[model samples]
Target: MQAVNGRILIVDDDPIQRRLLEEAVKKFGYRSKSATNGAEAVRIMTGPEAGEIDLIILDMVMPELDGLGVLERLRSDKIPTPVIVQTAHGGIDTVVSVMNAGAQDFVVKPVAPERLNVSIRNLLKTSALEDEITRIRKHASGTLTFADIITRSSAMERVLDLGKRAASSNIPILIEGESGVGKEMIASAIQGSSDRRNKPLVTVNCGAIPDSLVESILFGHEKGAFTGAVDKHVGKFQEAHGGTLFLDEVGELPQDVQVKLLRALQEGEIDPIGARRPVKVDFRLISATNRRLIDQVKDGAFREDLYYRLNVFPIWIPPLRDRIEDIPALTRHFIARFAAEAGKPQVAGITPDALDLLQQYRWPGNIRQLENAVFRAVVLCDGVQLTAHDFPQVTSAMDYPAPSGVPSNSAPIATPAPHHAPAPHTPGTQISEPIQAEQPQSGFEHQAPFGFMRNLDHDGHVRKLADVEEEMIRAAITHYSGRMTEVAKRLGIGRSTLYRKLKEYGLDDNGKDAAA
Candidate 1:
């Protein structure tokens, strides 16, 4: 990879020291800019040229405004550019003050080129990571007010209305919905419209991470905190120190991680894994889950206090089936979007019958699934408008049976390592090897041995614990709104175990009877 280039701004009242530092910075292949005093540095930073300067070297005793003053201004203005303080005072108090003032790094007076260079390189690396995250989140780009949502249904309008009111408050927000129901979209809209719109809105996907990495990912860790922990990582909370931290799939958080997260939320502080002290953070919290956390709390899988804390401003987004009135408007918006993305701007709209078919159907995957269908149609279409033929699956979807726990708007399905594939069956084919055809065989030739707890009926005949355990597992699943991750967690079993039980019990995620 090519070396990361950066622009350095030198701020010192003394032209002699400033010129020396500028030349030293240039010698290291970094472009340099100069500021006569701290005041000038603040102006340039808060002005048009702010984005150009990656690192600032500010002298503490500048005539007009000192180092601390400039740092304070930067902090107040929320400028994330890294600053290195140059102070004659090498006292510990001065160093602490600089850090407290939000300066990223500092060096003692008569700055050594080597020491300054090292600090700059480290800060720039961390800064680059943060910048990339910020670019992806796009604090301002993905932001939405209620206006951006295309909904005609009053039910959805109420959700957007409450979201609008919630945007003005700093209270914790809990969004509940089925998967692909636009929970993150609502959370981002709230963050962007809130008072801290200019600050970062960091998102954490709780279920996406491995259990072992949960604590480190959410609370961060110091360098050498654990094996393979090479550098200090500021967690999601710190990343959105003044804005918002949206924890998606929060119910999937492990017991240990939930404990630490509870403490952080309650105390407004976090103890990084290897840090000497706890770091204080002040940010709004937004959590989303398709599962009912209240049920998980009852099952002892989730903390009661954390649930209460997050549910302060509860907003439930109704599923697509419940608010089908919004389908047409949503379809228009998505077609326009996917068409432009696919470089087919001339695509006018969907056919009237096609729109009717979409409205008539119950979208199990919600808005996310709808978007995928539209995008796929736009990419494959050869006409100016999409027809029912464009979405052949939609016509057949009514009769299609969905698999357990997999959303219609699901991400790419993970193909597990196959133990075996089913044998091909031809019409009128008969197996004569095993002639007892009345008893059916399982699809898999090799079934993993499942231990069962035996029980006796009132008649005293022995029976497997299958009936009792199946009821409990099925009830837990229904109560938790069919979130298998939370179900497995509450049932004190691994996810693979839960899958086995679900299949063994003939249960699906329909929130009703058995799959058969």
Candidate 2:
């Protein structure tokens, strides 16, 4: 599915033209909210839904507030939504005036659908690219702050709050999250938010370095300190002096190195190899690891003392699957970036169905996985918008039917049946499937189609409330792969209530909850 093209606000007084424009916008794969006049348009743009409106199609002439007036109001309010002005007169002066008033593009009245779509696509693409470029610059300059984090989920908001609090002082911070949940980005933001802005944020991936080289690499060595140490070397700690040092995958450090790391954090200094005395280094420490350091400590793989020293202020970033609400925004951000990098200016947005497919999958690799997926989709996309067909791997994993007529070099994506089972005779084995213990006790043996609940009974009347409720419970169980906790949370009910309903409906098989 193509990403949601964008939300457009159409402002015009003529009812016929408004309806026509609305139809054209819908046909162009964009969702739109309409305003009868310019004043109403301004209100919508400044109201709570302002962020949702991506572009505006304003009539040049309207009562109370004209196109130029609306542009002035938006500019004064610092609302930068791209605008396209339309007028019946195609005078050069009108075009120039609209351009000067901050409209991105101008169109003649009774605009051709093709031309209008091109304008909207170009404007949205330009806006997305500009935002992406700004983010890239901030990230590269080590000036990225919490405000630069692209997120819309409440789960991430808590993470940001903790990061902000940790940034106020030189407290040791340990960022805990799965790989690719943006731990390094969090560390960078903390550094930028603190007094160390514009300072070096030296990152060392502990796991990526060889065990023999880890010690020397982290602490500078004098010339001829070892057999291969011919030249003096500066270590990560010294490089991060007066700034921030981010130790990624710090759990992988050798036990001997752990002792030195603990001492360095505790003493605010390090003993360089072959040095006359220990060198005092002043730097903030921020460590990140995908593994639970406590578990490593329990297993005696990581030193307990070192773990405690590094974990002064623990901030756990929720995984992408846990913060599913952020997928759409993150998807768009990645699409914009990759499209710009790939020079695919025409590739603007994704279809709603495509976005839905992405949200349904559990991204075990977190944000990194999503970013790669969007990058690949953008590269594969031949049209202006990305569709479900572009993400064949994801679809196949979910057992979704491959879109008709699109060619693929990989194995065909499977089609799910009404019972939520993949059709047989496919070459590729199914990755995972929804758990089904036994036939549901509700006795609607003929299952409603997968992903759709029955709204009417066999007699053409509305289904019984209890039956519908039972179907919903069953569907939720399957959709979440029998993870009762997630199912309950998504269903907006307490776990106890969910379990009771499962027992009441005879949907629970013994021991499923224990494993889940």
Candidate 3:
């Protein structure tokens, strides 16, 4: 979908200037949010919707809190959103003051759309590059702690708490989770938070290794120990000496290897292939698996004694759907990372409706699937903000209908992959393919006109008034660029009532009423 190029907060006291700037932002393929004065702008920059805002257009002449004041507040709060200050008189003194106060750029009051677009684009590009650099540096340092994890769910909090307690010791840790639930990240965090924080973290995926080579790969091998054994090898255990050894998919290890692994854990040493004696090793053990080790033990696929050793301090991570509360933060994090990586710094955040749609789906592939989806959306999206139409696969997989007014820039809908053989056809007879029949478009098909809301359901029955009201409010907010005053006035509701309805409907930026 053609997401808005970016979300620009317009902090201008003058209604005319705000409206004009909003229109210009829209024209430039970006979305705009309004703040009556600098104070409101600061509130927004520090509030729940902060991450979604890619840039700000600040007017210098606002009362209560001027553009310079806003810049100071943002700086003190460490908000990195780029700001473009606007003043009626673009004198050198005013420009210098704003820049000194942390403004990224300055524009004359009657800012031309072209000039404004260029300024916004350049700042976003620079900011994205800086963010990507910081992320890479943090990863390379291997100091990723629990704080680096983006989560707001209580379930994840418990996991982090358990992980923190477990990190205090070198006890064998078994992190159990479905595939892609970030088991490796948890393992890394454990190692990074442990005494071995400055040491190496050697990881081996047991499931990805061949059965014949599992033992040799984990415990090392001597030259000529087996066919084609050309040189002495230091295995994962040796490589992780004085550090940590993370065995991912540990449940997949062969039965024979499990015995040696148990012995190594118990004896604090390993007997490498063709070695004269056991070699001492000092490494922390962290194992992860998608399957239940208990089940594997019962099936005789895993040794029971080895299972108990690894399960000493088990930590289970919940799947994505169970922690839907984390979706907004995670989505924003991925958007930032992928947007930077894709060199589309202007691609800032996803619309609230898009976030809601994502939170509703059961992500069977978990965080890995979510990460990949955001990466794809960042690449496919042409606008600054991602919309529901950006995730066509998610929309199609969940059978979700596209929002009524948002136009899609996606490919044509393809039929699902077949799971069964095609039905038999008569010889020399033409048979109409049922799968080729016209299907309702979810997010990929060319959309209908904009500014119209669907009043009826697919069954032709009138939709509930509550649903229609919520949809109307959402559209009004998007249409007005989150100017609540304008939205309430247009909807014939008082501002307080509008805010109340927003709370009741759970339609604020973070998918809930931040004001409430």
Candidate 4:
């Protein structure tokens, strides 16, 4: 069992149930608090002493204020505490309703200690995961920094060394990387590690701002300088005095703005649009770009001098896919983080298959996409584990062949061999033995199989496989909007094979199926 780092709040009118839950949580090494009803729970959670409450287990059938009403009130009051609903009623409809009402999980009482522990453990794990992701983002955006930039890869290690040396200087720095890579993060880390760490680290998105306002936004304008100018305004440069200014997507800046920027960097002063004299200022410049500024300079779209100035120190952030080994760590980190923020304390971890799918994807959007995927999975997933079904969109987006070369449907079904001893044969008698099946020779046989399979009981009895293939096929066809080619790709089968299977299963709505 994992060490619990959060406080559990048990809300129930019955003293026995409250004590039962408190003791159960304490057995897992977690601290506990109790409330008699929804009103009391709300008061305790919102009061000055609410700092210790990390999660709540609310009884759904309480007197005066029921669980649903409490949920509504909490939502209305903007209390962010995570709540798991408990009730004696157990049914699909009631569970769905409570889940829809923002309850983390529904437990049928009398509460099983193991079930409660599973819920609480998963939630805390997810909370920690999300916190770490947010911390990474904040660290990348200049809010936090440490010695986390080191890398084992020689190329990245060299880059880290260079970044460290650059951080010690006051010269302007440029970071270049692909979209979604942590260029801005590296820039922030540099600022945080520099002597100017105490001062503000102002960031400006050059690509997001309008071209017309680019100059005026970076260099302040005097009153009456323009028609809309009501008073003298200070620009980002002036605001960043004695601090660090980060220009994200610096390659998008106009050539004219680049020229003025070059002048400011060289002279350490800026002349307002209508001002007669230039004002001296001191600040470090950190710029990032997904585009190649050297190419932009060669194309006459960027100032050569400005490029050289910003290039005095350079660093590049690698994409997430290049560091595939780090996916497990990153996934765990993000899951814990978002779980805490959403207040869902019962989500434990991703299933092994789900984690495999995550690691296999190319991650075109890099860490941002991974974080969003985990967030979506955590919210939509049921139970303690996140399954592949929870991330249907992600699985559907990937176009890789199934791990086994065989088609998804044709994949061999698994049934446990009987444990009983082989039947005895008469000595020296002409006896025939049941034909022994040939073992699979492929390397894939050594690895666990993918796709749906029949469940087995503890006593080793084979259970019927759920017949959802038709529904899955229909959904796949509808998802592709009746495009056979797309549906085949998503299902990881050839078009001809998909058509054959659809016809065999009577999944095709049209009278005729696609030609082989």
Candidate 5:
């Protein structure tokens, strides 16, 4: 059964341990698979089941391959699959090595089912949040006509519908979304399709302009307007007379500049610097902001009246994740466009499997990011179509799992693995299907998916996770009213482990009572 939470890949040469792990993971609602050894795990992870495998459990010591060896290989290839290394007795040093090599977590020999499951749940939760945040944070770019907006998603079609309607009038249009959902593209489309199409379409990035020059840039300046006034100049508003002026990132405009902008919009004119009289200007306003100006107005950063003026027609562009239905068409369009530009006759299109991964992958960068990724892949294309391996940035970014329980502000400690052979990619595999335990690759053959993390501090000191772990345990105990079970649940640890940690950290209230 496919897991509603996610899938797990268990790697151990020992059949008993593998079976035990499989049952434990399944008991926790995760679908799982087993690899006889580390080699098989690498193949499955880098091959067709690449996208499907969410987490991996590997034995530290195996026949031909070991857990540390596998971790090294993965780091070299930059695969971000969260790994839990289960080690044998007296393997603290090796476990430390595993942690330094970028393993998300490690389990000592005689693994308790609850402890292992707790780690898995935390990693999955963290990974999901990271993907969601990244998808919403990164921005998108470029300009094109409405006809160039290729999308099959109904959500996006509605965006287009509203944009086209707003374009017909001179009312200010506010296009919004998380960065990179193509706000600028919609702005361009509106400008292109609007009645002002024949007029010059001028654009300005409000956030990029220096605060001191914002007013002068928006409204023309005369000679001797200021110390740096070399010659009289027409600002964006005056230059775009009878045309459309697109102000991107308009939320960044300073309050002073906003007031001037309001006057320009309301009176249909501007006061040029050093001018004896106000200058009459006629330009259609098309402003765009990624942030909610409503919130800005509430916070007093934006003027309410000005916001209402600019928000006559508001169009929200959903992030790429919301309209993933457009991935295939967008992919095809990108492949063809980039290929022809590069004069690569070999580039035909994307494979069904590759397209699946693309769609499955969260697009933090949106269409602009997709365009860049496809262009890069096309340049690296050895086959007739773009393959998964060609888009390492996408795959690596997608597969990087965020381990839960990490503080929101804490950076994950990642260490670069020493030189190790990379994991070999398998052919003829699909991510959604069960991974067959295939023959192990001869040796470590490929680099980590992302280059392994570097030794962060001088002397490449390993972070003492024990200190952080103890602090967290104490914090949990204080916050949870000394309820061991609740603390364990919150921290993604088994009750026994929580008790052990409490005793180890001298925070065990029960143990204190017993001593008394």
Candidate 6:
């Protein structure tokens, strides 16, 4: 079952019943409070403690004002909270009446904790879905254009085109690429291009939010819902009403959260913290990740249901290495941009050799690294053009050959050049030789073969063999286009073993070939 965020408010005229419900919420790892009547509940809901509540358990029959009456007040006042009605009266008419009155779901007086939990989960799921629908509607009518992105690659251009089409439709979109490949930018572009441009584009970094706050962040809470909640704070779902909600690093969302998120997509409403009702929202969901989500589902880190919901339309951004041809255009674009920004008209362009060096190197960090490199070069350039000497040699280290006369037994061996033997001279001939010294390897030695791995050794300990093995495995997978079976065979391991290794390395094989 799905896990709901833990801020619940229990309202019952009977003290015993309210206490029982409160205890149940606590037993299930939720934080909750109790109210003797609907008036008290609403007062607490709108008070200083408003931001901590996620759901409300309201008793239908009570003194002073009935549950339906309270729900009407909430709706009329525009209070966005999910309310579940509880009544000793267990008739279809009663359930239907309360439901039509804006209650998300209704439960009998002798409700089981499991049943209550299930209803709450379903309500929260529906709340999220409604929010997504609202966001989509708002974005579809908005202004999303390609001019917002900073890139010259045709790959990016295609992405923008796809984004425009996807934004216009209600279909869910899955954006896949390496980290720092601008997946979020694509999502933003889609939002901008859609009808909901006037509405807020809420962003939820699935990887950044702690597991505990995932529910409250998505569905919002009522006032006094928790210990620290000073006031009501709308969640991303509510905040994105009639707009777009982008879930970045979606693969990192916890398993339980995935289930609820899936339900929200299936439904179209969300149960807010301490809310006695589920609010309907209209929003679009645009999700992005560097991970292969299908693999995560297979490995049980992500839900299969959620995967299907998000995979309706997929857009994969090619890495810089795959689109090396775009490097020159990108370099010139960035040079002009940085030069103008830095007020450096004298530094007009990059030397051909410098451009060649950049084109030859493999960019593991993708476009982000390339942009940084250009920015660094622009800042350091002293003349009208940036030459190979001005540009850092470390940029080309991955493709450089090793120096001659180095021992083969060196801890790390570099590639050797072929077919360049010098002619032998007679002894004491005193022949003058054209001297060509081997380029120094010190600068290159410390540079990681790919990207960020180089900086990990600042404390001066060699990376463990396991780390090396994992890097090689990842490199092999990338080299083979995420073909796991091919990688397994190359590594001389079984497919199962390879899968286990991938889990161990936190790698997923959904986008690329998992079966070779």
Cα error of candidate 2 at position 423, Å: 41
lDDT of each: 0.71, 0.77, 0.74, 0.68, 0.68, 0.67
Global fold similarity of model 1 (TM-score): 0.53
Q: Runs in model 5 with CA error above 4 Å?
A: 1-145, 401-516
* Tens digit of per-residue lDDT, candidate 5, span 45-126: 8886766677888788887778888888898998887888888754667767889988888888797887886677566544
Model 1 agreement with the true structure over 1-516: per-residue lDDT tens digits = 111145789999988898899888866646689999888999999997875677899888877688899999999998888898898898999999989998888888787888887777566655654543454455356455554455656666677777888898887787877788788878888887888887777889999999998888888999999899999998887898988899999999999988888888889999989999999999899999876565466468898777777766767676686677667556755666666668885564565667777876666678988989888888888886677788877876644443355333222221221233234222122111111223222111121111112233323344346666775675566434466787789989998998877777676654244645
Once fitted onto the true fold, the runs of candidate 4 whose alpha carbons sit more than 4 angstroms away are 1-143, 148-159, 399-516
Q: Which tens-of-lDDT digit does each residue in 109-206 have in candidate 6?
A: 79988898667655544454344345445445444455445444555566666777787877777777667677776787777776766667788898
TM-score of 3: 0.61
Ranking by TM-score: 2, 3, 4, 1, 5, 6
Which wins on TM-score, candidate 5 or candidate 6?
5
Q: In order, what is each prediction's RMSD in angstroms?
A: 24.6, 14.7, 19.0, 21.0, 23.7, 29.9
lDDT tens per residue, model 3, 62-175: 788888888889999988888888999988888789899998899996777878877876776566556656645655566667866667677777778888988999988888
Off by over 4 Å in 2: 1-5, 9-52, 62-65, 76-79, 400-516
TM-score of model number 6: 0.51
Ranking by lDDT: 2, 3, 1, 5, 4, 6
| Model 2, residue pairs in steric clash | 1-354, 1-387, 1-388, 2-350, 2-351, 2-386, 2-387, 3-350, 3-351, 4-350
Better of 4 and 6 by lDDT: 4
Q: Give the TM-score of candidate 4.
A: 0.54
lDDT of 1: 0.71
Instruction: Report the C-alpha lDDT of model 2 over 257-346, residue by residue, as the tens digit.
Output: 998898998888898888888999999999988765654664689997777777667776766766776787688778888988898877
Candidate number of the best lDDT: 2
